[model samples]
Target chain A: MTTTLDMTALDLRQVNTRLQAAARAQANEDYVITNPRGSHAMACGLDGPLGVTIKGSTGYYCAGMNKEATITVEGSAGPGVAENMMSGTVTIHGDASQYAGATGHGGLLNIKGNASSRCGISMKGIDIVVHGNIGHMSAFMAQKGNLVVLGDAGDALGDSIYEARLFVRGSVKSLGADCIEKEMRPEHLETLAALLDKAGADARPEEFRRYGSARKLYNFNIDHADEY
Target chain B: MCGIVGLFLKKDDLRPRLGDMLTDMLITMTDRGPDSAGIAIYGDAEAGRTKITVQSEDPARAFADLDAAVSEALGQPVTLTVVDTHAVLIVPDDRVAEATALLEDRGLRVMGSGASMEIYKEVGLPRDVAARFGLRQMGGSHGIGHTRMATESAVTTMGAHPFSTAPDQCLVHNGSLSNHNQMRRRLAKKGVFTRSENDTEVGAAYISSRIAEGASLGEALDGTIRDLDGFFTFVMGTRTGFGVVRDPIACKPAVMAETDDYVAFASEYRAFADLPGIEAARVWEPEPATVYFWER
Candidate 1:
């Protein structure tokens, strides 16, 4: 069975509480929200196997600190759509604003349209897949994650990256410090294929070029101190 | 962060609703900026005549017999219309310099002087300021509004946005500039004087000086990305056109929507929710470091 909540009538607190109660009781039922109208902090801090769908656009921090629950946004989203998520899936049907998924530890965030700057800054084991272009300085200081961009990336893509992999099917304007192009071997192709399958994206794995950390700035060497 | 709203009507039928739509768009971002508010309206232009909009804290004394005084000083007839703290003084186009000098000598602060553009601004919530100026009643072909949160300058009426540095030219800015002081000194050497400590004033002055030097609006905006150092989103209005540009880094947020009847810009998408024909309008974020302009 599915539960429906109208945000126009019930406040955010009540809706969040209902979702939390369902999560606490281990309920597997699906939930649908209506009339979001750019409201922030929807379906946040969830730790359940249930599914949640938002019918309209949302404001800042729409789904921060999520775990296990599957969340989907039917319309566009404001800044920080899925910051610091820990598992499960979150998807956006339309465009997303700046800092879409900053500093997340786990889970997959898929955006169907364009995403603004800093799409995955300071990430720790999160997979972000975008069907369209991403803005500048994306994946800055990222650690242990995979980012897939199907369209062109803005200036300074993957600045100062650490142990993270970036795959782009389109042209890159510029690469940031300590980030450089790498060879896409068969293993990377298999990994990207699995990720694309999991996200239900329709891109070919062979079309992407890989980029990663250069390992030149990992240690404080006197010869490389000037580059800092 | 600050909020900026601009509406440029392509069709003549939408001119009467310009102010009402602009006000609604500006007030939607009250939470983004609540310290002060301002607006610039470009109404119909009259041949061989221009108007100067001035604001005074002591309107009762400053505006007393002001029309006769200016008329006598310029040796020509002048018309004055007061709306709360603001008053528009109309004079012959040739006497604009003489009239502005006279008003400055009389200790009056000139907000903006041009044939078509009239600027109004103060330190307060946007809703209150809009009400005081009867924003909904005013009509024009195009207009721009700003709700400011003072981060780089003192909170005074002079520090408010929609800074007009040259005749019929105005600019509103969101985000800070890193090299304004250097640019201000450079522009000062080139005979462009800025009136306020606000960095946005320096940007306005830069554009005005460029246009005065015979550079097109697009050329001036292209120069901004090269010369101006910082994260900024600028919405500039001229007598006959409207322009928008963002910095190379594009740290600031800006969205634009266009329809057959008009073009609109705001800091976010929510500002366009109530606009007429918005559901059918083509909306997208303005590209970083690109200039978007439209003219009548």
Candidate 2:
């Protein structure tokens, strides 16, 4: 069954409580939230295979710490959207603000519009795909993940990156410290094609470049001490 | 963190509702800052008259017969309007400097002075500050407000935002400047000074100094990206309009919305949710290190 939750009538706490209860019970129901109006932290910490949809724009930290719920925002999302997710799919039909998917263990974050600065800072094991451009300092100190951007990237892409793989189809303003463009092998192409397909992106995987950590800063080197 | 909101009316029909709209936007951002709140409104200007907004700890004593004293000193008619601890004194345009000096001599803190801008700020909640100033009833072409979290300054009336270092111009900032003290000394050498120890005041002074040097609003804001250190999302107001700029890093959150009638800027999208025709307005986050301004 489909459940309609009106934010104007119910407070955020109550809405979250109901959604959490349903997810905990593994109800596997569909929820539609209306009148979000840029409130923060909505539909967070869902653990069941439930379907959730937010009708409008949301504020900071929306859909954070998701486990197994598929949440979709019909409008834009604020900073840190889908942050720290474990396993699930969180799709934003509009732009996302800063740090859209920071420090996630696992999940798929699909953004149809642009994402601002720090798009995937310190990400561990999440997969993020953006259909538009991303801002500066994206994937900073990221440990493990896959970030695919179909459009241009701002300055300092993948600074201090480790393990994580970055695929950008457009120009990068500047590569971050210890990060460089590498040849896109067949496996990388296959991975990008899968992610792009899963995210419903229309672009071909062949027209992209891969960037990753150069591993120079992995250890404390005395020779590069002056750069710090 | 601090919250900044600005509204510039593109249509005259929306001018009367500027304060009402801006008040709602500011109050909605009360959670971002609870230490102090301030607003600078660009209202009507009478010919040959200038407004000097002043604040006093003891309004009853400091404002009593104040206009009479200033009128006698300037040999002209001066009008005084008091709202809570703040008051606006209207004097002839030529005597703005003399009037400001006299007010300072009387222990009154000059918030700002301009032909059309009247700044009112206090160390209280945004709702209370707006109510005390009757912000909803006031009309303006453009206005800017700040809900301060007090990162780089004390929680005092003099330290509140919308700092107007030059006439018909004011600025509100959402982030702290890392090098304000150094900039303050540099501006002090050039005779540009600030009354409070607030870093935002130094930013305002910097912009005002640039404008004083014949820089346009866009050029002055561009200079901030080049010279000012640290993160900032500034919305500045002038006699004709307002401008917005963010640091190159843009760590500070800023959202702007525009329609046929107005252009609104805030630290978040929620502030713009209540604006008229907001659903249809073209909303977008401004690019970092870019200056965007609108003037009628």
> Top model by DockQ, which number?
2
For TM-score, the strongest prediction is: 2
What is the per-residue lDDT of model 1 for residues B211-278, given as tens digits with 9 covering 90 to 100?
Answer: 89999999998889999998899999999879999998787888888999989999877788778887
Identify the leading candidate in terms of lDDT: 2
Residue A42 C-alpha lDDT in model 1: 88
For candidate 2, write residues B1-296 as lDDT tens digits.
99999999988898899899999999999999888899999999999999999999999999999989998999988999998999999998999999999999999999999999999999999999999889999898999999999989889888889899999889999999999999999999999988889898899999999988999899999999999999899999999999999999898999888899999999998898889888778878898898999997
Q: Write the per-residue lDDT of candidate 1 for residues A1-228, one digit (tens) a residue.
A: 989999889999899899978976789779999877567788898887778999877777888888888999988888888999888789998888888888988999999999988889998999999999999999999998899999988889989999889999999999999999999999999999999988888999999999999998788889866877
lDDT per residue for candidate 2 within A1-228, as digits (tens), equals: 999999999999999999999999999999999999899999998988889999989999999999999999988999999999998999999899999999988989999999999999999999999999999999999999899999999999999999999999999999999999998999999999999999999899999999999999888999877988
Candidate 1, residue A131: CA error in Å? Answer: 0.6
Q: Looking at model 1 chain A, which ten-residue stretch has the lowest summed lDDT?
A: A34-43
Off by over 4 Å in 1: A1-25, A225-228
Off by over 4 Å in 2: A225-228
